[model samples]
Target: MAPEAEPRQPPVDPRLWRYAAASRSFFLVIALLSLAQTAAIVGFAFFTTRAIVDAIAGDDLTGTLAALTGVVVARALLSLVRERVAARASARVESQLRGAVLDGIARLGPGWTATRSTSHLALVAGRGLDALEPYVGRYLPQLVQTVIATPLLIAAMWQADAISGLTVLLTLPLIPIFMILIGLATRSVQRRQWETLSRLATRFSETVQGLSTLTVFGRQRRAADAIERVTDDYRRETMTVLRVSFLSGFALEFLASISVAIVAVAVGFRLIDGSLTLSVGLFVLLLAPEAFLPIRQVGVQFHASSEGVAATRDVFAVLDAAAAASAPPAQAAAPAQGADHRLRLEGVRVRDLPPVDLEARSGEIVLVEGPSGAGKSSLLQALLGFASATGRIEFDGADAASRPPSTWLAWAGQRPGLASGTIAANISLGDDDMPAETIQQALALVGLADVDPYRMLGVQGAGLSGGQAQRVAVARALARHLRGHAPVLALDEPSAALDAAAEQHLWQSLRTVADAGALILLVSHRESARTIADRVVRLNSAEVTA
Candidate 1:
């Protein structure tokens, strides 16, 4: 079956610019502050050289010390301000980027997310975004300040001494020339390293998630061997990246050092020939390295930032992939306000899949039974609005797509996610205002009243039996019922992990719920489930038999 065409994505680069624009004031302040700091460093270097020359020429020692002290203090304060402002800007940008990534993931839903590895997502959110910190806080402002200040510094040198200025100006291009050449060489290497890292992360995550299964099959050692191979590859790629990075740094350093030496030699010859004064020679010599400093610094920062740029490209790829847009329907109907919350999937067809029309009127139990690999799960997901489907799904005879799915239905998966928190927290799932008595009653309905909902459960439902996890999931659905809306409850394989007695009790509770006019749809293979269902629809090989 051909896949559906994805919705057009917004341009990622433009979105990045928007993110920067959101913190425009903060960036402006940082840029101005960096310039001030650069100016102070230049000024200090100039005056200190003058002070030395004056002292050597037998000028007053007291005045020179006082002036030098002031420069030192001012430079320190400027450095502090630059650090504070850069830190603040980096933090703000990181926060914004994280939020944007998460929002993009939410829009992509399970269809897109299922194709991605958890570790890859983790790296993007964790280390991938961390690489951007230096780019935003340090390199970005430095790049801006260099563009503004370098020309002015050149003009200042020219005014002081044309020979020195021209010499410095000529050497300026060499630094960037070398930087650009090395950067081009390392570009592919950086990209390869990022790819290798993502692959390694994906492998490690898979191994961890399946560790128990590997142990059960006595293949744990084999899994360890596989991880070792992945790690070795990662290590080799990392070393290659390091080697290229150091080589690039060495090239930039060599160019800048040669440029500085040439300027120093020219100034020395002129001074000996009596064409240049000592103070001006000293000033120009100091400013010569200054001219190439920003360019060289750019080289160094680029290597630090290359990983982030590569990661950002991947992040943008995820963001740019097709997503379902939340466009409002043209003829939207108001949400239903009474107990007659009938849910219906009429003539609904998912792309490249067989058509199935199903309905769950209020107070009815609909059983969706299917052979393994049938589209039962897909059907359930469609009713929950996870996947886009053709034709109309309605709530009380109104188009279901007209309103959000969460407004009137509760969905329970075969493996519902649990976090590291109290049972009540997992049940409430951040709906903190749910009354304690109501939570207890919901647990009681699922036969989990003996277990305290307030007891702390470790990560991923640790310390809970399979039955307990199923009951907790069931409890979550029941809690949704308390929202004062007769929510259409859809369960996928609710009896997969439950024992016979527990499964019977659960089915009885579901029957009771259905009897009370709450639509219940259960996906199952058990014969007992069919007994309680009002209508049983069997699906085989993607075809539904009513």
Candidate 2:
């Protein structure tokens, strides 16, 4: 499935100029190479035509052939240079744009992105952005040629023979007129295709995530029906795009064919009357094809790049929203702090959940317990600033909103997203400076003494038992706890998958954390987990809901 299209804009959106400018040095080289290629095309035509006339007249051919060969070699070298520069520029621009989109997602926080399905975002970032390669590598260079080479050829043709030049000049505008009409006809369909693909991807991802639940509920057949409907829609839309593409190609080719034929016919008559020499006539004849080359290529490249153009629109929208969210309202500032290390929440409300009031100091395990759908997790989410609530959360001596998540929270989820790798790497994901000794200590704390630090684990801890997987998750939290000062350990069902023995060991690990003066927030329903908490706060399932 594909991602949804952003609002319609130009094929090359204005927001993309920043990325283009970042690769300006490479683009500059490409431009220079294009200029040289244009010159070689002109020189190539002149020499080849001169060689033909010399052959017809029984004159010397060495100089004309030699010049033609030199021009061919020069054109080949310039083409190679152009390709290399475009490739580099393509890579650089793609990297910058992908980085921007990912960074915006990071800044906006998980809560916002969670509104879209996992598969949709992944597709947009991966394959959708990849479609831009042709846009940069092939289309952009042809656009530059159309801007530079086309005019030069027309001027040269006119200088050598006025009638031939007049015919070409009169017909040139028709090519773009056809291109514009094609674009107009296909724009809405292309946008709809992009959007439908995104919806299909999003729905598939959602179904996969809930497949077990669907199977249990005996609704898998219905899910299958929904998917089939989406696929059929996508197929229909794809056919429409192909139909338009064929029509566009046929129209451009027909126009170019007629225009070139007119030039050839006019030049032939001039040569017959002795008003134009054969060399000059052949020269103008050759130049006719070159004049239409760039415009035709531009139309093809434009069609190839439609998918990327749609994705860029969505990427830019995300970037714009992230920039807006970076600064909160003036009234949202937190009140000054009073305690050394304390977390206080007052009248905090998220969605339909009842207002919550809570307070805790450092050096304690504060357990948050409740029935399903009681908004226990929502409380933690609110503290993480992922949910909008009408309340104040003060950490240390300042407002929690004033600081980023890294400064105050160490979170481990119910389903730990442990990447496929060695145990040590999972423990210290992306934080290379974290010492091996620290990771080992974290593992030992969670009672995994025998697990080798470098042992291979399948994707998301596939090879590990349920208990060991949970322990790895706890170790991740502990590793984070060890690194940050004045941090809170926030765990959601950390012992849900563990056996009695493993659960006890995990509880003991939490006790050790609480005893060491770290503030901890544990969300669990098990008696073993509740037993280890310094203070247990259990709300009735009916008390609140989000």
Top TM-score hit? 2
RMSD of 2: 6.5
Off by over 4 Å in 2: 1-8, 13-29, 73-110, 122-130, 155-171, 200-232, 257-281, 314-352, 357-373, 381-404, 413-426, 436-482, 491-538, 542-546
- Give me the candidate number with maximum lDDT: 2
Against the hidden reference, what TM-scores do the models get?
0.68, 0.70
TM-score of 2: 0.70
**Candidate 2 least-lDDT 10 residues:** 331-340
Q: Per-residue lDDT for 102 in model 1?
A: 78
Q: How would you encode candidate 2's per-residue C-alpha lDDT over 176-263 as one tens digit per residue?
A: 9999889876776777788889889988988888999999999999998999999999899888988898889899999999999988
Clash totals, every prediction: 0, 4
Clashes of 2: 4
Error at 10, model 1, angstroms: 17
